[model samples]
Target: MSDTLLTDLHVKYIQNLGKNKDDLTYHMTAHLRMNAVYWGLTALCVMKHKDALDAEETIEYVMSCWDDEAGGFGAHPGHDAHILSTLSAVQVLAIHEALARIDVTRVVNFILGLQHPSGVFAGDQFGETDTRFLYCAVSALSLLGAIDRLDRERTVTYLASCRNFDGGFGRVAGAESHAAQVWVCTAALAILDRLDVIDVPTLGWWLAERQLPNGGLNGRPEKLEDVCYSYWVLSSMAILNKLTWIDSAALTRFILSAQDSEDGGISDRPGDMVDVFHTLFGVAGLSLLGYPGLDDLDPVYCMPASLIERMGLKKGWKALPRRL
Candidate 1:
């Protein structure tokens, strides 16, 4: 399960954007906006391979995605500002140690503006609310050292309402449980020191059930496996203090098999396209499994060594108890 291939592919993604190009402005197409996830992935990969990246230039590109008008960021220039992208943008900048380049006060205000009266967060000004946006809201605030900007009590109550009868979390209240949403909601609670509010054991059991015979994890019961869920489910279980409940060895095999040896990244499945999104998560999954080549990732934030240090938050298994 050596990740040489995966790292190489990620480097290629970074390279494809061209040298000295602003990542925030470099979109695959003119109509498609630069996305926060892309910048986040770029920042993570840059941190992972600092010696290999033009760090300062890359950070500048990530910062360009910030949309000062709407009090949040967009995926790229000309895109609507959104909580999800704003979170990624802030986290990426933090990871790059470039938080100084951002207007912290305005960014904080932007995140605060997205919070509705009910404690639910809209993804953007359009009022599309979801648990995913809630995760972004919390995570962005955490990265900014601005968690105080959020109404913690109301936010936690809203997150609790998204919990489904299946013991997993959903995108919104009364929606069906989903693995990605479960990760977002669980991580939000962990970051807020409210993990005990959920039925940990039941959620852990449901996450464990997502594992397929092929060694990959799926989003929900009976769904096909995807590489992205490897991070979603594994990180959630890790935050819950229940990684032992899942088959780590089998999942590792599936993740490694998805690597495109020639291209240098892992795909969603064994023969699929390799992209930055899966590349970061693939490494994150390996880190969760205690893979030798990588360092331990924060189960809640999914950030790397440097950015976590910059935040100076509590770390390791002990931090888990504090959340409880």
Candidate 2:
């Protein structure tokens, strides 16, 4: 009930999230099924409880979401292929070392085909463009070892355009800066090995300012703090090597306090209804803060540190010293 992490209860909560297919919420969240699976799986990895979710069943579920016609994965079976869900699918498969089971070439083609002449990427064939989709393309390709197929110069140019005067990146060029956009832009550049395009000091300062007196982070100025930004903001700063700018101890306490101690998950803030997205970010934020007995999270890839290291994708980002 205190600030201590309730790892076991959280694990149970994640494990049960996909069990009730007949539940109304499950069907309602079908659009986010792929992302929700990644969130749950990565949270388990960070908690060192990856076994809580059956690997074979999980892999089968991911495969089921595959869009055969488009050669990309969808949020759920029968859904149209999207860059967002495709990235989540790749992340899930990569974590389990099941990438070999997928047709990487076709998936890579599907991702690349979404790119626009302007260098930004659309979420799907319907053409909703965002810096978020661009990041997804970059990250997914990198995980599949197909980043070499992307036009690196063109991709970095688009991201550079998204940079704002406040040293934060936005959802699109000239848009207002938001923490979530900053994370994707920053992390994408990190994977692309183009951090030189980032104004590190300025963006670091802007990201640090996301922390408020309550020790939680908000997506943008004048917004209320949300637990999910704990990952968005902290991971960006971690990628920029400026994690020390914020008070980790205070933020750690804030995240812990937001956990649903009895029901087992976390919410946007303390006392809110718990869900899988916030739960993953809450735990990941703690890991980046160097919380004791937690696994390291690769801020750039948002996967397990050990896996990123094994893949030789570790960048300059540093997590706080694990207290063991």
* Candidate lDDT values, in order: 0.74, 0.94
Model 2 C-alpha lDDT per residue in residues 9-40, reported as the tens digit of each score: 99999999998989999999999999999999
True lDDT of residue 70, candidate 2: 91
Which clashing pairs does model 1 show? 9-264, 34-75, 34-76, 35-75, 71-110
lDDT of 1 by residue, 1-324 (tens): 343335655666555645435665444542333442443354344336644656676577666766767766677666677776677777667666778888888888877888898889988778999988888888888888888878999999999888887789898899999999999998899889898788987998999999988889999887899998988999888877788887887887888888878756667888887765677677678777776545556767777644576577643421112110
Off by over 4 Å in 2: none
TM-score of each: 0.88, 0.99
lDDT of 2: 0.94
Residue 269 error for model 2, in Å?
A: 0.2
- Residue 141, model 2: lDDT of 93
